[model samples]
Target: MITGGTTVNGTGVFCACYIRQSRKKANKSEASPEDQRDKTKGYSDNEGHHFVDFYEDIGKSGYDPDAERKGFDRMMNDARAGRINMIVVHYASRFSRQNVNIVLMQVLELFQLGVRIVSVNEGEFTSNNVMDLMNIIMRFEAGHNESRNKSIAVRGTFEKARERGGWLGGLAPFGFEAYKAFVDGVEIQLLRPRKDESKVIKWCWETIKRHKDDTIKQGQRHPGSLAGLVHQMHVDKVPTRGARVGGAWKDALWEVTTLNRILRDPRIAGYMAEPYGNGKKAAYRIQRNADGTPKKYGYDPILEPAEWWELQAWLDSRGRGRGLTRGESLLSALRNPEDEPVLNCACDKSMCAYYGGGTSPSPLYRCNFRNVPGHNGNNTMVQHHLDEYVARRIFARISTAEEDGDTAGFLLEATKRFARTQEAPSNARERAQLVTERHEAAQHLKECEEDYKSVKDKGPATRRAVLEEMDAAETRLKTLDDALKALAAADAPALPIQQWINSEEGNGDPMGEGSWWATATLASKRRFVTLFVDRIVVYKSAMRGNRWVQYDASKRVSITFAGEGETEEASEAA
Candidate 1:
């Protein structure tokens, strides 16, 4: 006996429709939410009454109804509050799984809560007396049919969308744009290379090919013009998404920074990448944290193996920012051992390059192989800082050991581990190991060379085979030379370890004149550190109280005091 329309605030009325679609319905080829929303809009017109706002929990699997989702709870609350007099649903199962029998509970609960209910798909409700087993069973069958039909439609939509590579929909990189293109469902369109930047990409590839010299530039000297080439794009009025982001040239264009995107674009190599960088090409830049330290390899690769090497060569030759390589690595350390080298790159390929050549210049090392974090971390150092970092670490360690009267023990242990010390095989073993590796290498080279010489130049393929053999022989010879050097041991202390370990500045100070310390070459001093300690990491000071940084690279410098037992990055995770 409802008279004036029941006040929906605390007295539930009009139908509340629940449109439960299959979980597989999400991204399925069936109709979109917008279209479904529109269809629901029509129901209000047909019924001639206002409805509670729709509650959508679209992609949820019905089996777990209380899986901490939003929207669904709000609907239930309104029902409990009697704010909704009637509940409308496209079907009963839309409210929950059939096995849970949620529809009967919702009906009984609303009735107890002082709310009346009406279902759009099911017939109007009556007194509890008439609603017998036969009626309830019929209603359940209707709901089951609706769920099945909806599932079929959704699956058809997804199968079509996936085949077309349509707009699955979400944000992508910075440069390219996205659009729609599927037929049965929503389609996705990806970025294609723009014309202007392609020319520049080609230029970079050509440069790498041009620089591939074995004897002429055997050891890898990065080319000098990589920066100029990137700049040239700007000079030629080449447009980039860089223009849109503003600080591009000054921002992304720098070496190992933005310029890498241009050179590494796979569009220049051949085809579109599986998923490319935002820039017109599928150029994947390495991932980094907000602070600029690399987090992992980039999602997309922008440079080619050859082009990347070329860029490294160019940066190596530059010596600093003016010629700084694109990313961090040990090359920087090699260029400026006085400065610390970057220790690692998180690139999956793991082989990071280093660069040096700046004021208070420091070398850097890190991998650029892949963009997966922790994946390529070894190829890429998780972190690196300051050029003298490793040296500083070793010196500091020795200083501590000297203070603790463990100087002798530290040096002895270090030499035993990494150098040819007394504990090492005596002169006889040293010479034997050296001669053995050398003999093997020499034999390998001779055999390869002989094979090459004996091969007749009967055809083009024969000549090519011989050339490959000769190249292999040369590589083997170089390996042999390096190995023999490693085996050669000199036991005589350049600076008597006992003196260095015993002096007042024992581990703290470098050798003094003939007074209390012996002399050693810079090479030897550096070698001493490497032979014992591994690496050191520098860090920004912490703001927390009484912060101390401890370096654990088995080495440290005593050039300055780190203060009362402070811990640095090295200590946090060495």
Candidate 2:
């Protein structure tokens, strides 16, 4: 009989069996959960102990503290609650492979609670016996060391395989599938393009490219948004990867999130990516060489590196929180010289486009948040009026520069300023450092604002102090923003302004039908506006007549030209 104190129900020692198998050995034949449970049950029965229950943690890693082992926790809880006098396991390692010190503490805690731990192979452990304690400690140490060594060996093996372009055995990325191939006389898995999935990926890139080309060359707007792509795919009945449902494979529908993932994945460009951590929301960074180029696997690339980079640049230029929508109109890429969105309501929310119903003639830009409670601004303006007013102002500035024989110098300076707003830092290390600094600054500013809000009912002196802190944080953030802009400017590529200036269309009158401005693509017009304008601020119309009557652009609009400190009313009479 087992020599254990504190028997439950005054009958025999109540024992609970704990079984664990790490994910690495989950599929192995040896030391399975069932095998461990059977051995522990036989050992407990041989010792005349009553087996009350079994706690099994399958495919769980004992070494990782963050790994959730629900069964192990429940077993511990049962022991602490005096429900079980003994705990049985096939081996000490099956109970835990945590650090030796942690295991020792757990064993001591169990012993203090009058619970004894029994291992089928290692025998019983008692608090009074020095030999038993030492044996338990040594067993835990051995388990930990074994796991550590195996981890190191496995990591080294994976790294070497990655260096040699070998697939490390997991589901292949969306556009490809894994296939067995002979490498160095050894059969190994490699990625091969899956035709159906590859076609979807190719279609996405082609659509974006065509949309961009048409906007820059033919002044045509096309439906190329992520949402548009999803709609078209549904209409065309494009096949996504199938999922098994009730033993039958069912075709999955394409979604924006899925398409976004495909667009953002570096694997499509044939580069390996390293995950940040094991968290569910953890991001991945593309592995790069010393020269900052992405490290490529041996698989055939689905998209060219240049094409992928260009796509990324375009996406980034769209800014945060802006939904991927149709790339239409001249103001799609509109921003001030400082790179801030130019169209903001008096209530401080950014304006959005609103297409009127079939009865209306033109689209309108208005504050989408005007209907929200406590928001009072209802700023709305016709889209074409603003577009034409801005276009005319830009053309006049270019005409003045040309008349003064300073077109070359004027265009160069303007292009450089515009490029700074559009470009990002090229040096990866510098970019990462800037990003970290920006995040910290933003966090500090947020804390300051939260503190100010929390202490609003406090003394005036305290509120003032909090206000000062907030101002300081805002200043620091602004300084970081300026630094980022300067860094981007240093890395900005030269614009093709010289070629545009030399064309025959450039010499004609800008307001005339034959002028470059008249025929310039929407993308080109936006580029011109960004080069010459610092900001465009719109105010509510003051006309006392019907709201639908044509509003004067000069009365409601203010334009701040680049390199100017003063804002001027946008007027044709200027």
What's model 1's lDDT at 325? 32
Give the per-residue Cα lDDT of candidate 1 at 158. Answer: 57
lDDT of 1 by residue, 376-396 (tens): 222212224333355445555
Task: Using lDDT, give the best candidate's number.
Answer: 2
In order of appearance, the predictions have TM-scores of 0.35, 0.69
Q: Which stretches of candidate 1 lie over 4 Å from their true place?
A: 1-12, 19-50, 59-69, 101-104, 114-117, 125-532, 535-574
- TM-score quality measure for candidate 2: 0.69
* Predictions in order: lDDT: 0.45, 0.69
